[model samples]
Target: MTDVEALRQQVAGLMPKVRQDLERLVRIPSISAAGYDAEPVRTSAEATAEILNDAGLAARVIDGEGGHPAVIGSISAPDGAPMVLLYAHHDVQPTGPEELWSTPPFEPTERDGRLFARGAADDKAGVMVHAAAIRAWDGRPPVGVSVFIEGEEEAGSEHLPDLLARYADHLRADAVILADSTNWRVGQPALTTSLRGLVGCTIEVRTLDHAVHSGMYGGPIPDALTALCRTLAALHDERGTVAVPGLKSEPSDPLDLQEDEFRAWAGVRPGVEMIGEGGLTERLWTKPAAYVLAIDAPRTKEAPGQLVPSVRATVGLRVAPGDSAADAVGALVDHLKASVPWGAELTVLDSFSGEPYRV
Candidate 1:
């Protein structure tokens, strides 16, 4: 058989074992966020390295500065072969609420052809794919290979750039396969590109020293919560497009994912239409989108019927790839400052921002 055909046959034979290994790794809840415990993250990384070693590579853990440990492994090929880099991560996002999942998020379960777990679809499957492909190559391919599986991608790869730089020589390759988070249909493959830059800010509006009865002070005094919501509401137009200046980018030609297929894949409610116009790719990849992620104002359970003293909310902006987070945030802040209703005093604080990458 031809090399490609041979590789495909080998990988086909290894699929069952690969699925088992992926399930084994996905069973562990390797959350790397600040609030979650760290041992699981470490355990997942170490276990991943062991998997790679068993596949005929020298693998071990490298301690990232503050994030979870990173996994690096290498397998040598014959001299004069090309080297490729394989990337993946071991950690996952928190399961969120238990009710949101059909099955327990940490418990790896299989229904139909797809595996269901918090990390199953994310990176655990990617890791298994890499292992299967390499093992199909039988310890060495026509090319050299190095793998870097991280433990903190979901929490932002805070320390990976440094790790990449530190191990630059080892990671140098003709191509890098980042198999952490993306897919296009089950059979069709996709190479994800152009990540939207993200910037977030919280605006706090303070009006009186303390809470007062709404019946008495509702007319003259400003309700901080109302003012905050109004300001946030103005950030988007009636069509859901961002209304802020300089935050928008040139829209690109839209991509075509079959409408019925997309709806079914996303599990959208029947008869619900998709939002925005143009190509699916253009709307998501090139345009700016603003959302109010959270409101930190007093809860109604504790909120007195009062002209509240203060209210706060968070705004998140997803800018096109070329747009800078700083500039987008500056425009957003400016718009909020100018748009505050009445003579209400406003305080805006910029929060974490990550430069959007074009992968």
Candidate 2:
């Protein structure tokens, strides 16, 4: 048999073992968000290192600045082979609202050939795929391999670029594979060439110092909720597009959803047509998407619907490749403050900001 066929057989033989390791890695709830367990994050990082070590790769834990530790591993190939750099993150997004999940999020369970877990689809699966492939070559392949498994990717990978620069000489290679992303859909292998960045802020409007009885002071008092609604409504124009200047440029690329595919993917019940014009890929990939993430105002549990003393909301703006994060946040704040309906006082607070990468 040819060398390629032999390599394929070796990989197929290790599939079961690789699946077990992947499930084990997924069981660790490595959430890097605040208020989550930090120990599990550390455990996941170490587990990744262990998997690399077992495969005969030089693996170790590296401390990160104010973030979960990173697992850095390396393995050399036989003489006269190419060197490839691989990257994957160990941290997972917080398993939100357990009620939404069919099974426990951290407990990796396989059904219908797909692993159901928090990090399974994200980077864990990618990690296990690489490990299995390397083990196919018995740790030493035809090409050199350097691996970087990070724990803070879900938290914005702020410290990763610095680490990469610091170890540039060690991690240098002809190609770098960032396995943290995937194709738009299953069964179609896609290389994500672009990613959208984000900027967000919280805006609060105040009308009264304390809650007032709506039955008594409804008409005279400037309602904070109404003011907030007006400001939010002004964010978009009659074209159903964002009114914030310099925020959305003309989209260049297209999105995945074609007309028929969009109707199915968006669950647009039968006769509904997709929103906005032009290519779906361009609309989602290159175009700007904006939304109101949350409102901090009192809910119906505590405050009566009648009382409109103060209102607050968090707005998120997804920027294109050329837009600036700081500029987007600033423009959003300015718009809200300038559009108050009842002359109510307004305050905008900037929150987390992530700049979009053109690559």
Candidate 3:
């Protein structure tokens, strides 16, 4: 057999162990969001380091300024080969409403050749990819490899700047591979070269100086909640596209994805129709999207009969490439102010921006 075939066999032979290690990682609930236990996040970092250590690298878990622990592993080049940096995250997103899950969120269950778990694919698999590649080479690769398994990526990577500054030399590489995107197909992997930035903010609408009986003031006076709902509704047009002007948009590269496939993947309901005006790939990749994440208001059970004085909502914008997040957020604030009905007062509680970048 040829050398290429031999390498393929080595990789295939290594799958069982890789799957085992991946299962080990999937079991750790490394949720980095506030109010969750921090110990699990730390445990995931240590587990990632251990996997890399077994793959013949010098690995360790290190903490950044007010950040969750990150795992770093390094293997030196034999002589003159280029250094490659592999990036992944050890932390997983919170498993929301566990009752909705078909199986336990932390338990790795195999069904029809696919593993079901919270972090099984998004990014515990990435960590194992690095480990398996090194093991395939018998712990000695022709090129240098440096691995960075982030611990708080799902929580917006809040402290990434500190980690990058502190570990500049160790992470410097000729090329970087962040294994945090979708594969082109089941067996065909994709390389993400461009990414949209983010803008998030909380806005408050105050329509009443004081709470008044909704029944008594029903006809003439307006409530803050109603005004807030109107403002949020104006974020999209009749076509369901983002109505905010001045946000950058570019067509995505055409792909072989069908609407049925997208609906299936997204778990769209039987009667729900897809919105937005673009090819599926364009809508998914390049075009801008606005989402209302949450609204902070009194619960229905404990709600008083009085009209709400003020209501606050947290919204997010996915900024397209070539648009600065600062500019997009400014436009968003302007749009909210314009959309508020009955001249309700609009106040931007806080805002955050992340500049869009392309490789």
lDDT of 3 by residue, 203-274 (tens): 999988888998998778889999999999999998889999888899877898889877887799999978
For residues 39-110, write the lDDT of model 1, one tens digit per residue: 999999888998888787789999998779989988774688778899988898998899988999988877
**Most lDDT-accurate candidate:** 3
What lDDT is obtained when candidate 2 is compared to the true structure? Answer: 0.80
- In model 1, the clashing pairs are 214-305, 254-279
Each model's lDDT: 0.83, 0.80, 0.91
Number of clashing pairs per prediction, in order: 2, 6, 0
* Candidate 2 RMSD computed on C-alpha atoms after optimal superposition onto the true structure: 3.1
Model 2 residue pairs with clashes? 253-282, 254-281, 254-282, 255-280, 255-281, 255-282
List clashing residue pairs in candidate 3.
none
Per-prediction TM-score to the true structure, in the order listed? 0.91, 0.86, 0.95
Question: Model 2, range 1-359, lDDT digits (tens) per residue?
Answer: 34998888998899888888989999999998888889998999899999988877898988787778888878875687778888888899998899999989988887887889899878898788678767988887778998888888888788888887877877888777888776677678788777777888888889989888888888778788878888888777766566777675555654444677756766888875455444677667676667788887777688784768888888888877777788877777787777888779988765767777676
lDDT at position 155, candidate 1: 90
Model 3: lDDT to the true structure: 0.91
